[model samples]
Target: MNHGIEKKARIVGLFLFIGIVTGIFSIAPAIDSTNYLTEVNTNSNQVITAAIFQFTMSLIYLGIAILLYPIVKRYSQSLSIGFLSFRVIAVSLSIVGTILMLSILTLSENYVDVSSNNLLEIETLGNILKSSRDYANHVFMILALCTGNVMLYLVFIKSNLIPKWISFWGITGAVLSIVASGLVLFREIDIITVEYMVLNAPTAILELVLGIWLMLKGFDKRILKADEYENPDSCTLGTIHNG
Candidate 1:
């Protein structure tokens, strides 16, 4: 692989790793618990840390899209653009979720101080915030991510940028992710439940493998050479012969 392509692959892989780690850490037990309204105040630091990690993960999501766009666009401009757009949407929703988490923490602080007469009202608002956060983080955000990942894997499959099996695995995982998100949206399953986690596990595992592959091996050298030959004048391919 050329220096440019190799460098991009490594960075993308690193971002994927960071994104996954942060995403996992971003789930604050206090805010995710059933009695979050009463628990968040006691675990304020945990909630804040989770929010920070979530924000970082959102940025990493955007970064991965931006880094991959140029390469994927060479194979299919429309798919690349679609992938980038969906990732942007996912990142935006993630940030919104993070904000909602902090909002819930604030509500928790108030819930602790409120009198018994207003406890019900505070609980009601807390529920609304919690639900909104769930939808933003788990439902809508996952849908967008799945959509983008499908597009990305499609490009990879067509271009042979990575192994065919890996690309197929990505597509399958994306489909599973979409199903999970749909179930959540329809109220058939709850967030953080065993069913939901199982549905998401494939995608999470795929990402982990894909990240390691990209970091270690980068794209398929044969495909890169083929692409370079087909588009000799392309800026991205111009350096293929050099490094």
Candidate 2:
């Protein structure tokens, strides 16, 4: 519940996520011996490794979320906004996104063995992954809009939990996510498409910034106090006698 501790955890989680993204985009690209599919195949092991690392960092982020939600909810004095409300939505969508991403990774991993393995199975799995990715991205962007930007922003702009600029960035990030995912879905770029790849870093960077900010500074004190009251144990009931 301490803002200081929450900030530290956020920073740690952010740095971990940064490391994972860097490993996937930067380090992974350099490892490929061939430049043809260099973007796709280079340092694949590193990319997979990065995915695993990101997954681990997500778990840490989840922990931070768990600790901070009650504080924000209680302090804010309103369940309409803050950590708990936003997180309930954010986490649900994040789970969907994570699952889709994992499916995509698994299918891509097996694609290399198509000739030696079952071609039909590979194709089927690829379709499933692509569909999941498209759908998940759509839902994820929506979640950002509902939870990160709309709900959290109400608290930030009003409560001063975080700077206005940070809230602005969160809103911007939400919009960008929707747009990027739109380009991928409507334009059919979710699977190795150039448009999706082009928009990837910008969308990711925005989310990175937003995520870092949230981890560093949580919701208002009013929300945190409210959370305590909602716990039931914190409440004291007066004894009554039938007169």
At residue 108, candidate 1 shows an lDDT of 95
Worst 10 residues of 2 by lDDT: 234-243
lDDT string for model 1 (23-130, tens) is: 889989998888888889999999999999999999999999988997889899999999999999999999999999999999999998989999999999998999
Please report how far candidate 2 places residue 237 from its true position, in Å. Answer: 16
All models: lDDT? 0.91, 0.51
Q: After superposition, how far is residue 117 of candidate 1 from its true place, in Å?
A: 1.8
RMSD of each: 2.2, 7.8
lDDT of 2 by residue, 26-107 (tens): 2223222232122334345654664465455455545545644433443354643455555555546555655655555555
Off by over 4 Å in 2: 1-44, 75-89, 92-118, 137-146, 188-243
- What lDDT does model 1 reach? 0.91
Query: What is the Å distance of residue 146 in model 2 from its true position?
Result: 6.2
**Candidate 2: Cα lDDT at 158:** 65
lDDT of 1 at 76: 97
